[model samples]
Structures are given as C-alpha cells and as structure tokens.
Target chain A: MSIEIQNLSYTYDPKAKFKKIALKDVSLSVEDGDFLAIVGHTGSGKSTLVTHLNGLTKVQSGKIIVDGIDLTGKFDAKKLRSKVGMVFQYPEYQLFAETVQLDVAFGPKNLGLDEEEINVRVKDAIEAVGLDFEQIKDKSPFELSGGQMRRVAIAGVIAMRPEILVLDEPTAGLDPKGKRDIMELVLSLKNTLKTVKTVIMISHNMDEVARYCNKVALLKDGELVGVYTPAQLFEDDTVEKCGLKLPTTVRLARVLKARGLIENDCLLTEEEIVAEIAKGGRHA
Target chain B: MREISLGQYYPTGSLIHKLDPRTKLLITIAYIVMIFFIDTFVGFGLVFIGLMATVLISKIPVTKILKSLKAIIFLLVFTVLMTLLFYGGDKSEVVLSWWIFTFYKQQLIDCGLIACRLFFMVLGPTMLTFTTTPVQLTDGMQSLLKPLALIKVPVHLLAIIMSITLRFIPSLSEETDKIINAQKSRCADFESGNIFKRAKAMIPILIPLLTSSIRRAEELACAMDSRCFKDAKNRTRMNKLKFGWFDPVCLILFCALFFVVLWLKFNFLPFVDLTSLGWIV
Candidate 1:
C-alpha cells in the first residue's frame, strides 16, 4: 500500500464554542502506482483530508500509515515531506524568487541537497514539465505568462523528487489548453517514473477525474461518503444527491444508452464512449 | 491568529450611529477636552455622569466598553503608579510609608484625578470607533487633513494606502493560515520548539508567506493599473463627508472646553489644584 488511513477523524477547535467536524472516521487505502482523485465542494474537508496524507495535519484520533510507516507518531516530518511532495493550489502565487531556476531550486535547497544534485533535479523537473530550460531558467517568474508560471511552480515541487506527488487544484485558473497540457504532463510522469508510486489529487472537475483517476474518494461535509472504483461511484444513484456531477463521458454514455444506440453499462472517457459508439455503428 | 480585531465599530442602530462621522469625531475630541476642564471632584463627577449617559444613549453594551478597558488595564495601572510616585505638592504629607516608598496625601489625590482623566480620555473617543466604521474615520481624517496638500503632501495617496492596508489585513491572515497548513502537512512542527528553534522553523513558513505577499502585491498593482489607477490624481470621493450644523455645534463645545482647560491652567481651582500642596515639586 502506498497510503493507508485507518479510522481517521479530525475536528477543528474541538472544545471551542464554534467547534467544527472537518473529518470523521474515514478509512481507506491506496495501492502502489494508483492514481487517486478526491472530489468535494468548498469546505467539504477534501483539503483537510489531503493535508493529512503528508502529515501536514495530524490525525487527532486515527491512524495514517504511509508507505508502511505510522505517520501519527512524532518523527522527522521534514524528511517524510521530502518523500511526499505537494504542489498547492494557485502555486504561482508562491513564486517569489527573482528567476525561475531559483524558484524551482527552492524545495531541493530546503532539503539541504548539495549543488550538483540540486542542479540535476532542477534540469530533469524543468524538462519533464515540457519547459525549455535555457529560455525560462533565468527569467524572473513574474515575467512569464500565467500558464507558464503555473507550470514552473509545479516544476518547483517536482524538483523535490517525491515518490508520491500530491496536487491541489493544479489547473485551477488555467485555460482549457493549459489544463490539457498540465494533465498530460502529470500522466506522463506517472507512467514513466517507476519510483513515483502514488499520485493523489483534489479536483472539482468530474470530467478530468473520470478520465485519469483509477480510485475516487467522495467526501461530503467532512465525512467520507464512499470510496470506490470510479465506475462504481459514478453509477451509484446516491452520487447526485450529494450535489456532484456525473462525469461528462458517463453522462454522454447514459444519454447514448437511453437512445438505444449503445448496449454496454457505461464509459468514463471520450475515447471509450466513442469506441462504444463505433461498435454500435457496425450493429446498426 | 486571533488578536487582530480591526476596530470597535460596533454595528448598531443608535443616536451615536446617526451622528455624522465628522460630528462624532468632533464631539469625541470635545468630550476629551471637557473632561480635562472639570476642576473639582464635583465637576469630574459630572463629566463621568455625562459620559455614562452618552454610553447609554449609544446603546452599546457596557461589557463591550469593559472589554476595551480590559485591553488597556496595564497602561492604566502604569499611569496611576507613575502619578503616585512622581507627583508632589506643597501641603503634601505622607499618607502611607513602606520601606523606601512614601504615599504623599497630595500625590494620592493627583493620582486619582490623573487616572480618571486618562480613563475618560480613552473612553470618550472610543465611542467614535465603536460607532463609526474605519472607512468613515479615514474619510473624516482625509477631509480634515485635505488642507495639508498645500504643503505638497499626498493626502489622497495616504488615504488609499490606509484603506488598502486595512482591506488586506484579513486576506493576508487567511493566506498565512493556509501556508502554515501547507508547511505543517510536510511535518514542519511550529508549536513545540525553543525560541531559536521556533524562529528557525518559521523560515519555511515565512519564505512562502513573503513570496506570496510580494506576488499578490504585484498582481494587485497590475489590477489597479488596468483599472486606471494612473488617473488616481484627480479622483473624486465616492462618498464625500459633509459637515452639518451638528458638526459646528460640536466643534464650538470642544473649543469652549479647550479654553476652559486653558483658563484652569492659569487660574487654578483650589479643590483640584495640587500646586498649593506642592505636588508639582
């Protein structure tokens, strides 16, 4: 298992007049190399749950055993963080260094990595994000376009070389093309990097999750509604009751199936939906 | 994360809220002056009664005022102590003695008067904040200080800066909270280190915070520029503050009080005058 959360519960200001239950009795496990997508509305506790993965938030009354180690115990958290890199929402907002290279070097430098290793990692990270090294390496982060700066921010986290990469709304404000490019880069990294064992992301875009995520965790008002394979969760009638959208491809598949043009249960991606339609065309 | 309550500005419908901010500001100033003009304990007593009446009319909870008082308790204690130790009088005689410390009778009286005066000074004007929004206060201040532009000072710029900084306080606080959460996720323990270790631990938090602040500032500057901040030169007020008859009436009362205090300064009243007791020495 890449990550295992057992009987997890957390509350904010538990004894205060305005105590809030941010998380409750959520138990789940992620397999190695699994791509997990968590979906929830604002304040639904998705942020709180993801923060717990890297030990950002302590499990007040539950266990978060990551990579076979009990993270609930007090340990060298900084070292643990290096193994679980987090690229935050609006990451461009954190770019403060004078140049892109320096900003990307920040996390690695914080790890106390020597100059040679840091340089090698920065080069690989920049290249992996499809950014031209020489052109952008020395430019001030403020000087880049929004999408470019966002990618550079991602590269900064990537340079830290974590086995499990966690992204919080990585494409939040990007244009459609920018979003596609970022998603593609993420998929490529997951496919090629053997040591990159788990990828967890929080997103509201159902279509994006349906296309890429193998496992989905649905959170509602800080409680784990269900954890299931994407197909099982989407096909369940209760999903819409929680104010969630059916994935775009799944919706289309349902529409096609209703019109008697498709016979299979459902599809979760544009390609699968189209392939199913092509199969129907031969039958017609 | 919690100590920053912008200002009192208690949201309520009351006679104080109905008063023009300019009027409230003027009256608060006048009230402080009037408080100082009270010569004897009777006059001081009258001032206290008047302030209490105003507080009642404002309809603000007395507990709220007491909360403000609680914040300034240390300052109040220090002021009273200094008055007792330093103030002297001609007829001053030791009321109590403990080792090297002497409590002179005249000094005791001075201490009581000064402490009450300081309390009234804080309490009187605090009503302005408790009644008026910070925006109104800044607007009042800008209008009052408009003539200072004759000295080439950028009054408008100062107002914009004040308003923007006030607006960003809550925003920056929330941002700092998020960044702290982000760092903590990585096992950065902030709460359990020595002074030096804690300060060192803050580096990870501060770097991201400072970086984000600068980035946001730049974005804000860009947004302001696009919104024609360049034409910021001759911008008219969205809500101009107009002085009414109430404002002049309040100003006159304060001017009268100021003159009375000045008069008392030269022609001191015997009961309130500690000079005869040689308290000034």
Candidate 2:
C-alpha cells in the first residue's frame, strides 16, 4: 500500500496569541517497498509529518490517505495505526509491562487479537528484534540494558504486524556499535517481517541515510524540498543549503572527484566509493 | 496542554519582571492581606484601579490576564449570586422580589463589589506568575522563609525539591502528550467507551509518564551527586537575587498605597452600618 499526502498544513493553538505554524502546504507520496529517509533541521516538521501518517496527530488542514485510509475526518485510527507502526524516539521510555513478552504483546492485545494469535505474534516479534524470546520473554523489561529495552519497545510495536514501519531517530543516544546494530536490525526486520513493506525513518545521521535509505525527503521550514534518490540528493548542494551536513563517505567521494582522483557519476556509500577507486583512478 | 496559558509565565521582559522575586513575594503577600482590610466600595474601586495599573505595567495582554479568571468563573458567579440573594436590606429599598429571594439596591451594589474583589484576587496571582518564572518563584519563597532555617527546618532541601518540581512541570506535561500520542498509535482508545473503560485507557499513558519521571529524578540525583551537591550548603547562585534600584522605589510606592488604603478603611463611613447590627464592636 502507498501513502499520499496533499497540501498538509498544521498550526498549534491557532486562536492563541503565539500560534505556531508547524507544517505549511506540502504534498508528497510514498510508494510501498521504499526505504524512505526524512531528513531536516530540527523543527522542520519531520516528526509532525510522520505523526500524521499514523493518525497520531490530527489533520488540521490536509488530506492524508495512508494505505487507502483517509485521515481527514472520522476514520478509524485503530486500523490506520495497525497499518503504520510508529517507533518513537527513546521508545524505551514507553515500555511499562512487567515482562518482555507482556510488553511485546501490548499492541496486539489492543488490536483485540485472541490469546493464541497474540502469543504467536509476541514470540515472533520478540525474536524478530533479535532478542532471545525463550530466555528474556519473562524477564522484566526494566531490567534489560538500554539497547535491549529499546528493542523490546520496538517489538511491542512490531507485534501489531503493521505493513509500514516508521521510526523517529531509532538509534538516538546510542553508542557507535549500538547504533550500527540497531540500523542493521531494522534492515533485518524488513526481511523477517513480510508484512512490513515500507520503512520510513527520520534521522540526522547522513551516513546511515546514504548507506541504507533508497530515497531521501528533505524538509526545510515545513516545506518539502522534493524527494530524491540517495545518489541524486548527495550529487547536488541541496543538502548543504538545507543546513544539514553531508555523510563522510559522500564528502570524501566529492573531494576525490573534484581533484580528478575518481571518475564516478554519483557515489553515496563507502563501498561505492571503494568500488569506484578499484575500477581505476581518473588520472590512471 | 501548552495552549492553556492560565497561570503560566508570559515572558514580556517588562520592568515588573525585573524586580527581585523576594520583593515581589513580599508585595504579593501584603496585597492579599490588604484585600480584606478595605470594606468600602470606593476602597474596592481604588484596589481595582491599582491592580489594573500593575497589570498594565506587567505588559501582559489584558485579555490573557482576564483569561486566568476563567478558572474561577463558577466561584465568581456563586459569590455574586449569594451576595445578591441573601442581603437583608431596609424594608423599603427592595428592587426586585421573586420567589423566596429578594434583591435590593444595597445588595446589587454589594454584588458588584464582591465580583470586583474576586476578579482582582485571581488577577493579582496571575500577574505574579505571568511576570515571574517558576524558578524565581521558588527562590523567592526560599529566601523569604530563610528565618525558618534557624529553627532546624531543611530549608535548602525543601527549596531544591520545590525547584525541581517547578522545573518538571512543563517537561512532564510535554512527556504526557508524547505518551498519549504513542499509546494512541498503538490502537489504544483513550477517548471512547464507558467511564471505566476511559479510566482504564489512561493506564498506558500514566505508567510511562510515572516511570520516566522517576527515571529522570534518579538521573538528576546522580548528576547532582556527581557535582558535589551534598557540600552545597554554602553554594552561591549564579543569578543571585539583588534589590535593584526599582526595589526601594517600588517599596515606597506600595507603602504609600497601603497607608492610603488603611486610612480609607478606618476613616470612611460605610453605606450600611454593621455596628448597629452588633456584628462589629
């Protein structure tokens, strides 16, 4: 299923004196199977836009048809949420159940699933997040490490078997190894959960964006600056103009190309840069 | 929740906002005490004028200050109703009589006076909060009650707790919003169903909010401990409270107004004589 957003605009406390226009008139669409990266400077309406995709925030002045569900009026939020699972920033703080199994079962239980289906979904989801279900399912979620707690929180959302998975800075406040592991886990989640057809992530790490994301949607001042492929986004000066830093791989690739060290059209990842150099130096 | 501007700080950076919190605290206490001293209509009128002038000087929008009174609307109406209906007036001055309640000119005037008093009462506190941050407020309270420390009160600890409580108000409200939204995305129905169902729905929001709040408190304790908070008995504040030039001038002005109000209270004759009814000595 695809999502289409049309002319979305949101203002907080519209009648108050200090009303804030959060999102302006913007239009975009995401097709299924696309691993989309939403990158913007802080308060660029990335979170606001993603919240609307799952009916977390009400539609103030826009039309969002998320996976054939119109979120403009009295649509079923339960159905929409089951289609789009949101893993918020520092999601571990949202964990509250006594055991890891219970926490992972919270969403499916809310979906009104029966006992056997919930058990199956909970076990699958817990295992899908790379946690040992047999060993840690009965353990208190609070007793887990920070990264494990975060995984349990994500498992709670994944148990709903949503067709689309949305993450807002999934690796925030993590160590370097933890960060890599979580991103790789998200990649694995896409493979393990056939129901999850699309992944939308809001992140500041341009290296992760360059490495995993197929399409990048840049937002500036609540306005969409056209969706572009990872290669196309890094090929121009748009990322810099939007007050975002480039990935180290893309920067090195650009510097090498400028000095006539490599003859490559567009290089996004370190492996792409390495492969381009292996083909031969431009001076060679 | 952020949209509720009632009793929240409004940063206008006006002259009133610059006054020392201790001075503001003292003057607020005095103003509240003085509200009961004046019984005359003219005196209440003067108090109204004084409160409005201070509100104007605060640079807060007049409507925003009025908005704070919305919390006490029911009380205001009840007070006005009681004063109007229960006034025992002269046998000849009845303005309207309906059912068991009789309204008189004196009662109508008393109703107006009571409403004005209640209106200004809410406005006075609202003005303080709008002009002062919560940190400044607790600091002011701690400084004013420093004398209690000599009697073995845990003054510094009390102040720190109060300060943290104030600091967490906005953050906790923000976290509540996030948790509610997160639960809503999990197909948690917080708005529908019977009362029991709705109350039960709050579990998802409250548990996360409570846990995070406790976690934050623990983290803050650790951070404070690492910074040698235990040895902070002689700790100096960076934004030390000092009486600026406005403090003395303001004190004098307030004193003058207070004496004038006291003079008006004792010297003026009321329209109704409670002494004749033996309610006063």
Candidate 3:
C-alpha cells in the first residue's frame, strides 16, 4: 500500500507564545517496498513529517492517507500504529524491560498476541537484527553494550511486525561499524521479512542514504524541496543548495568525470563509481 | 500540558524582576502573612488592588497571570461547593434548602472570603517565581537557611540539588513526551484502560524515563566532576545579589498595607462602618 500526504502543515504549541511553524505545505508519496530517505538540516521538519505517518501527531491542517486509512478522521489508532512503527533518535534510551526477551516481547504483547506468538516474534526479531537470541534473550537489556542495546530496542519495534518502519536517525551516534551493521540489518528486513514492505529513514549521512535509499525526499526550512531519485538528486547542486554536503561517492564521481575519466558523474553509490571506473570509459 | 504559568520565569527587565531574590522571597512571605491577617471585604479589596498593581508592574501579560488560576479552579469549585452545602454555624440565613443540604447566606460570604485568600496565597508566590530565575531562588533559599547550616545542615548541597532539579524540569518533560510518542507508535494504549491497566501501561513509559534520567544524571555528574566542581564554598557567582532602592520601598509599602488591612478588619475604618454593608451580621 502507498502512503499519501497532501498539503500537510503543522505548528507546535499553537495558540501560545512558543508556537512555531514546524512543517509547511509538504506533500509526498511513498510506494510499497520503497526505501525512502528523508534528508534535511536540523529543525527542518523532517521528524515532524515522519511522525505523521504513524498518526502520532494530530493532523492540524492536512490529509494523510496510509493504506486506505485516513488520519484526522475516526480511524483506529491501534491499526494505524501496527502498520507504521517508529524508532526514535537514540532509541537505546527506550530499553527498559528486565530482559532483552521481555523488552522485545513488549511490542508483540501490546499488539495482544498470545504467549506463543509473542515468543516466536521476539526470537525472530532478535535474530533478524543479527543477535543471538539464546545468548541475549534472558540477559538484561541494560547489561548489554551500547550497540547491543540499540539493536535490542530496534528488535522491540520489529517484533510488532509493522508494514512500514520509520527510523529517525537510527545510526546517529554509533561507531562506524555499528552504523554499517544497522544499515545492513535494515536492508535485510526489507528483503527477508514478509511483514515489513516499506522503509523510511531520516538521515544526515549522505553516503549511507546514497547507498541504501532508492528515492530521496529533501526538505528545507519546513518546506518540501522536491523528491528525486538518489542519482538524480546527487546529479544536481540541489543538495548543496539545500545546505547539505554532497555524498563522498558523488563528490569523487564529479572529479573523475571532469578529468575525462568516466561517462557518468552522478552515480549514487561508491561501488557503482568503482565499477564505472573499472570499465575504463573516457569522456569523448 | 502547556497551561502552566507558575514557576516559569518571564524575563521583562522590569523594576520588580531586577529586585534581589531574597527581597522578593521576603516580600512574598510578608504578603502571604498579611493575606491571612485580613478578613474584611475592604481588606480583600485592598489585596485585589495590590495584586493588580503587582501584575501590571511586572510587565507580564495579565492573561498569562490569570491562566495560572485554571490549574486550581477545580479545587476552588469543589471546596466552595462543600462549604456552601454543609456549613454549620450559630446564626445563618437560609438561602436555599434542597433535599438534605442547606445553603446558607453566611457560607456564601465565607466562601468568597476564603477563595480570595487561597487565590492570593498562590498568586503572590507565583509572581515571585515568575520574576526571579530558579538559580536566584535557590541562592536566596540557601542564604535564608544559612543559620540552620550552623547546626550541621547541608544548605549548600541542598541549594545545588534544588537548582539542578529545576534546570532539568523542561528537558525531562520533553523526554517524557518523546517516550510517550514512541510507545504510542508501538501500539501501546495509554488512554483507554482501567486503573490497573493504565498503571500497568505506565511501566513501559516510566521504566524508560527513569533509566534515561539515571543515565543523564550520571553524565551530568561526570561533566561536573571533570570541571573541578568540588563544593559551593569557593564558587563565586557572576551576578551578585544586591538589594536595590525599590526593595526598601516595597518593604515599607507592604508593612503599611498590612497595618491598614489590620485596622480595617479590627478597629473599623472611621469613614465607613463595615457592618452597614451587611457582610457581617
């Protein structure tokens, strides 16, 4: 199912002195099974937009339809939440259960699943995030390392088996290895899990987005800049103009093309650039 | 959640905001004491005038100050209703007799008087908090409790703890909101449930909130330790508190109002006999 947003606008703390216009007239669409990346500067309405997908924020003045469910109408919140699961920034801070198994079981239990189903989902989720279910299931979540704690938290959300998984800065403060590990796990979820059909990630790392995301949605100062293919977005100066740095791969490809080394300078990922260079094509 | 106006400082750079926090604290005490000492409509009228003047001079919007009344309005109504329905006294005219409950004209006046007392009791301290920053209040508290420190009280440590708690209120609230939304997205139903179910639901929110708070407190402690924060004995403040000219003027005016209210309630103002108004039978 595709999610549609139309003319969405939001102001925080409305009718007060601290009111701020967080999102302004943003319209976007996400098809099923699409790896969509939302990129923006800080305080640029990225988080506000994703929170709407799960109906966490009430639609002040707009329309958001997810899988035929219209938000702002008399709709089932539990149904909507089960469809869209959100992992907030610093998600490790959300781990609070006695054991990792209990923590992972929290979401499935909330969904009112039976004891047997909860156990199965918890084990599957922990395994899906590349953790040994037997080793960590009975252990306390707090006793784990930082990266392990974060993985356990994500496993909690995954245990619910949401159709659309939205992550806000999933790998924000992790080490380099932890960052790659999370991205790999997310990609695995798309390919392996039958329940998770679409993935939406808000990220600041341009290289990570270029490698994983199929479509890129750009936002600037509470406004939607535009939506484009990752290659198309990197091909132009739009990212830089929007106050974001270019991906390392895109930066390298530009120099190689300028020096008559490759035919395409807008390649999205590092491996694609390497492949293009290996083909030994020169600009005529 | 945003209806609060108390304990939130509004910086307006007015003369009242510039007064020493110690002076403000003392004045608030004097004002609360005077409120309890007065029991006449004339005295309450004088108080209303004083509160209005204070609100005006602070440069905070009158609407914002009045917004704080919303928090205690339910309590006010409940107490007044109880008193109005069940008042027992030596002499009281029956205003309304419904079923087993009797409403008295005497209780009506009493409720009005007590409500005003409660209202001013809250507003006076609220005004002090709205003008003075939390750190200043903490410092003033520590200074006031200095005499108790001679008896082995940890006043300085208590001051630091108070200031830190005040500093973390906004951040912790923001964190709580985040956790609530996160759990909501996980299909955690916080709104619809029996009391036990609701309390059970809070486990998901509270455990995470508590853990995160502990983590944050540890980080804060480490940061403070690295900065050589040993004790408050040698710590110097950049902005020292000084009693300005308006402080003495405010004190004298408050004392004068206290005497005038006392006279109005007891000796009876010569120009107008309060009994003629029929407030007292």
Between candidates 1 and 3, name the one with more favorable DockQ. 3
* Best candidate (score: DockQ): 3
> Candidate 1: TM of chain A?
0.96
Tell me, per candidate, how large a share of the native contacts it keeps: 0.30, 0.70, 0.78
User: What ranking of all candidate models by lDDT puts the best one first?
Assistant: 3, 2, 1
Task: Judge candidate 1 at residue A102 and give its lDDT.
Answer: 82
| Model 2 pairs in collision | none
Question: Each candidate's DockQ score against the native complex?
Answer: 0.28, 0.63, 0.66
Which runs of model 1 end up more than 4 angstroms from their true locations?
A6-21, A58-63, A67-75, A113-120, A132-136, A236-238, B1-5, B8-23, B32-167, B183-281
Candidate 3: residue B5 lDDT (0-100): 40
Candidate 3 — which pairs collide? Answer: none
Q: 1 or 2, which is superior by TM-score?
A: 2
TM-score for every candidate vs. truth? 0.74, 0.82, 0.86
In CAPRI terms, model 1 is classed as acceptable
The stretch of ten residues in a row with the least summed lDDT in candidate 1 chain B is: B272-281
Q: Candidate 2's residue-wise lDDT over A189-239, tens digit each? A: 887779899999999999999989999999998889889998889887899
Winning model by lDDT: 3
